[model samples]
Every structure is written in C-alpha cells, then in structure tokens.
Target chain A: MILDPDLPLIDRILAGEQNVFAELINRHKQYAYTIAVKILQNRPEAEEAAQDAFIKAYQNLAGFNRQARFSTWLYRIVFNTSISYKRKNNKVFQSIENTVIVYNHEGEVSLEKTDKTRYLNQAMMKLNEADRTALTLFYLDEFSLDEIADITGMQANTVKVRIHRARQRLADELKILLNHEALTL
Target chain B: MNRLSQAQEDILLEYLDGTLAAPAKIKLEEELRVNALLRLRLDELRAVHTIFQHASLAEPSRDFTARVMQKLDTAPSPTPSRWPIRNAIFLLIGVLTAIGAAALLIASGVFDGSTSISLNDSSLPQKIIQQEIPVFTFSGKLIINIIIMLNIVVGWILLDRAILRPYFQRRMQA
Candidate 1:
C-alpha cells in the first residue's frame, strides 16, 4: 500500500480530508495536461480543460472505482473532457506546413531541427485524435494494453489492435515526416 | 513492408512487451534465432517501441498545479446540496420575476422614452440629428480603429485555424 500513494490519499479524501486532493492533483496534473494539450493543441485551453477535469473528478470522487488505477480513470476523464471541449471550441483546421514528408530512409531528409521532440509533436498532429491518444498512452506512459483499454473504453484485445495499428500509422507518418528508414533515433 | 503479416506483428509486439504467453514466446524466440526477416521485423518494431518510449512527456505551465488548486478552491463544494428542490424553486422564481419585470418595463415604454434613465438625454437626440455623428473625439476614433484592427487580426487567425489552414492541409495531403 505504501507503494501506491493513491490508495491512502483516496481514503483520506473520502474520509473528509479534502486537502489531500492537492497531493493527487500534484501527482497527476502533468499527465492530465499532457493528454489535454495533445488533443486540444492549444496551451491555455488544455490547461483549463485539465483543471476542469480535476474538479470534475473531485466532485465525482465517489464514482471512482478503487480497483482501478487512479491515473487510468483520471486520464479517461481528461481525454473525454478535452475531446468534447475541443469539439465545442476548436473548429480549426490543421496545417501540415510544419511537416516534411519523407519516406523510410530513402535519402537525407531535412530533420535539421534541434529536437526530435518537436519533430515528433508535429508528426503527431497529423494523426487522428484516437490514434494520437492511443499512442500517447501506450508508448509515452507505458500503460498496459488492458489499462489503455479500460481508459479508452475499448476491450483489451481491441486496445492491442489499436496500439498496433497506431504504431504502424505513426511509423508511417514518422517515415514520411522524418524521412528516416527506421525510428532508430 | 516487411514479409510480416499483421497478426504476426501483433504477436511480435506482445512478445516484445513480454505480454505474450510462454508457448508463443518460446515459438517466437525459436523462430527469431534462424529467421533473418523476422529478426529484421523485430528490430523495426523494437525501434518504434524505443522511439515511443523516449518521446517526451509534456509538463504543464509552471503554475499548472497551483492554478488547478486555486480553481478547485473557488469551485462549489463537492457535497450534495441539502435542499436542491428549494434552491431550484427559488432560482426559477428569481428568473421569472426578472423576466416579468423586464416585460413590464418594456410594455410601459421604458426603453423608448418613459422609464428610460439618462443623465443627459436632452442633448443626445439634437446632437444625433444635426451633426456628422456624435460623441466620438479623435482619441476615441483612434482607439476604436485600433480595436477594430485587433479584432480583424484575431478573427483572421481564428479563421485560418478553423477553415483556411485545414482546407489547405487537406489539399496539400490530397
């Protein structure tokens, strides 16, 4: 139980120690903001959405299942909230202006950008919402397929398929964007 | 691609993730030892996995947690309300009374003339009918023009994000 602070914090919060929620907020805010930013693609809206998700979770604390990982449950709330907020707010069309379409390591590509993180971020923008979310959870956070399934409301095997397809699609995208043969970097 | 089937890739991924069953693991390992294409495919999968693993985790703005806490502090308490029906009735009554009052005021010619409240109503109409527009000085005009320019710039950016950029992106991709 000491390994997972969420259990104790949850108990304390349920026991009327409301401030114990600050600890939970601190623990999870980065990931919440990360997912929101990925979906919203706008910093201020993502931050607001993440904050709203936290307050929503706190209000609905009793609905949280103790058996599930708090991160997974919280991420689900953030993902859904951000996606809906985006649907309501972001009627924006995406541009591939920042993109460079290179196929798998055929030639020297223009990846002279300082960081692959920026490159990766731009590449991710090209994917649909679902694929980006799935890939972010699976690869970035290392959530298990089952946990991702639970969070994304898909079955475990369905999650596996989604992740697999996302990887292929991402790889294809990166190949085009980075013009690298393999994702060796 | 590779000489790999999608199902085989799935198995390879599960195997790489160490989620594959022991039997499948054993069979895949046996195959990997002698099969070069399978090994190459495995490497490719591993590279993708590695790149994903190394991808950056985003941090929020510095005050993100503090801001969330601040908002939570301002938000309504999570406890269920004790007299929700009473609160709802009071709310409805307040809304209806406000609406009724507005209707009464309007019917009594409030907006037009009778109940209209103004500190300098006498000069307003005379100035409006007799001049080249009223109440805007040079500074006011400059400020208004600046505001209009700002709105146009913001609108253009929004329009680009919402419509033009996406249309062009789709066109470029197509």
Candidate 2:
C-alpha cells in the first residue's frame, strides 16, 4: 500500500499542531477500534483502548520511525494498548456465550446476516486471543504476514505458522460448532 | 472437516495463500493432480480461507473521535522542560561533586594508616615557618556549614525531581 497521505499531517502534529491530530484519529479509529474489539471482545473497552492508543501515538509521534508504514506503527500501538487494557481489566474476560457477533449496526445486517455468519462468529470467539487476532488480521486482507508480524511482534514465518494453525483451529471450531450445518458452506 | 497433519497443513496453507515458492507450488500441484484426497483437503482449506476472509469487523462508537479528542484535551501535557534533561544535569553535578570529594578524602590519607587525625607525631612534617595554606582557611565550623548548605540544595532537588515530580505524574495519570 502507498504511504498514508496523512504522514505529512503527522509531521505537522509532531511540530506542535496538536489539533491536527484529530484527523489522524478520524482516519484510523474504525479499524483501530475493530482490532481492539476483536482482541478484547468488548465494545466499550475496545473503544477506550483505541482511544488510549491514539493518545499514546500522539505522545510518542516524535519517536515513530518514518520508514515504517504509519498504520503498521499505529496498529502495533492499538494491539499493545489493547493487551494492556485486557490485563488491567482481567475481570472482563468472560464466557463468549453472551457476546454476539456484530455486523454493522443492529438493523443494517440484511445482506451480511446469515446462519453461517453466526456460526463463524461463535467459532471465532472460541479461539484464543492470539489465534483470533491472527485470523482477524489475515481476514482483514489489509496486512501481509510481515506487516501482521510487525504489528504483533512476531516473526514473519512465525506469523505465517500462526495464521495457518489459527485457520485450522477456526475451521475445526466451525465444523464442531455447526456440525452438519457446516455442509451448507 | 478434520485437522490436517502439521506437515501437510503447512504445505497446503502455504499453497492456498500463494506463499509457496514456485518450486514448492509446482511440487504441490503435481501431488494434487494425482492425489484425490489432497485435492479434497485443499478444497476444504479453501472454503475455510474464504470464511475467514469475509469475517465481519466491529464498528466503533459514533463519537469515537470526539471521545478521543476529549481525552487528549484532559490528558496532562507532558510538563514543559521535561525532567529527563534536568535530571541528567543534576546527576552529572552530583557525580562530579562525589568524585571530587572522594579524591580529596583519599589524598588526605584519612582512610590509610590510622582512623584518627592526631597531628602529634605523624609524618605530616610541620613547616618551620608555616605558610598560610590558602586564602580561606579550612576549619571545623566552616566544613560543617558548607556540608549543611550542600545538604539543603541536594534535598531540594531530590524533593523536586524524585519525590514531587513522580507524585504529581501519578496524579495526572489517574
């Protein structure tokens, strides 16, 4: 992918135009929040963690190496910040029984909603955090294994292995969760 | 529908993801042409890949940006004149002063021969006509006064940088 055009705005913000940082936040907040929610599996905490990550990126913008993709760097922060948030709020780790897979807003799911989607969501929640994150990043189709490795601090081949194993596990989970229903896919 | 063996899974995954090198891809393709089970396995993995590729992502709250901006507004601006620079200066002065004081103590032979400084019969020969040592004489009261002043200055800096600075920083984070 081409370098974010917002990199210049980042330069401006680092030079002390703090208000301009709002644009960066607006640009990345959705995927950042999506990443956090995928890991934390909670909407509010994901929102807070994403916010915290942006705040941290703002604080450390001066130290951010320019050669790296800004999204790679920012997503790394989101990933790490969400992990810390998870650790700090360890009590929030609960059974996935209550968490519903969200597809757009509640009423916007006409085309996207299906039994297959529901089963896949259930299977995803059953996967461990690392596997879930690996699968999510892989499925997002926005990052290569190397970029995913950078974001998650794993080696590229390790990321490949992880995605491979996680995919297998997710497939196994979907098969087990859906039983005969999986044949429809 | 079942788990693939570690080796088989790795090859198949690499092939499915198009990450298999040309040689490996050629090998897997050759195997797939003859191996019906391998073809079925590949088809299974392909289906799984499709589902994961289409996995739904979560959406952020409508005001995520505004909430973040509000948090940024309230977050403490890192204090002006970040203490790291000031702390380095303080450490340099502290270390140099400590070294100077140590060298003086060693040169005086305070820790060598005897614990006491009895000028009575020591090899510290007296000058026949004692030249005044310096412009300012070293006396007990003067050393004590100097030490007290040094302690006060060091105390203030320690309080500011170590104690007070961290306490306020904790409060800011809270």
lDDT of each: 0.69, 0.72
lDDT tens digits by residue: candidate 1, A70-124: 8888989999999888777654522322223333123334445444555556667
By summed lDDT, the worst window of 10 consecutive residues in model 1 chain B runs over: B112-121
lDDT of 2 at B123: 56
Q: Calculate the i-RMS of every candidate, to one decimal place.
A: 10.9, 7.0
Error of 1 at A161 (Å): 0.9
Off by over 4 Å in 1: A1-4, A14-16, A65-67, A93-110, A113-120, A140-142, A178-185, B1-3, B21-36, B80-174
Query: Once superposed on the true structure, which residue ranges of model 2 sit more than 4 Å away at CA?
Result: A1-4, A95-114, A180-185, B1-4, B78-174
User: Which residue pairs of candidate 1 clash?
Assistant: A92-B162, A102-A176, A104-A181, A105-A180, A105-A181
Please give, for residues B1-174, the per-residue lDDT of candidate 2 as tens digits: 354578987899888777789998998899999988788778767868877667666778888888878888866542234466468557756855764675577567553433334344445557653543323334554454466567567756766665565565445434
Question: Worst lDDT window (10 residues) for model 2 chain A?
Answer: A96-105
Task: Give the per-residue lDDT digits (tens) of candidate 2, residues A1-185.
Answer: 23557667875776677788889888888779888988897888888899999988877776664556888899999999998988877754643333333432243334333466666666677676666776788878888888899888889998888888777776676556555444434
The DockQ assigned to candidate 1 is: 0.17
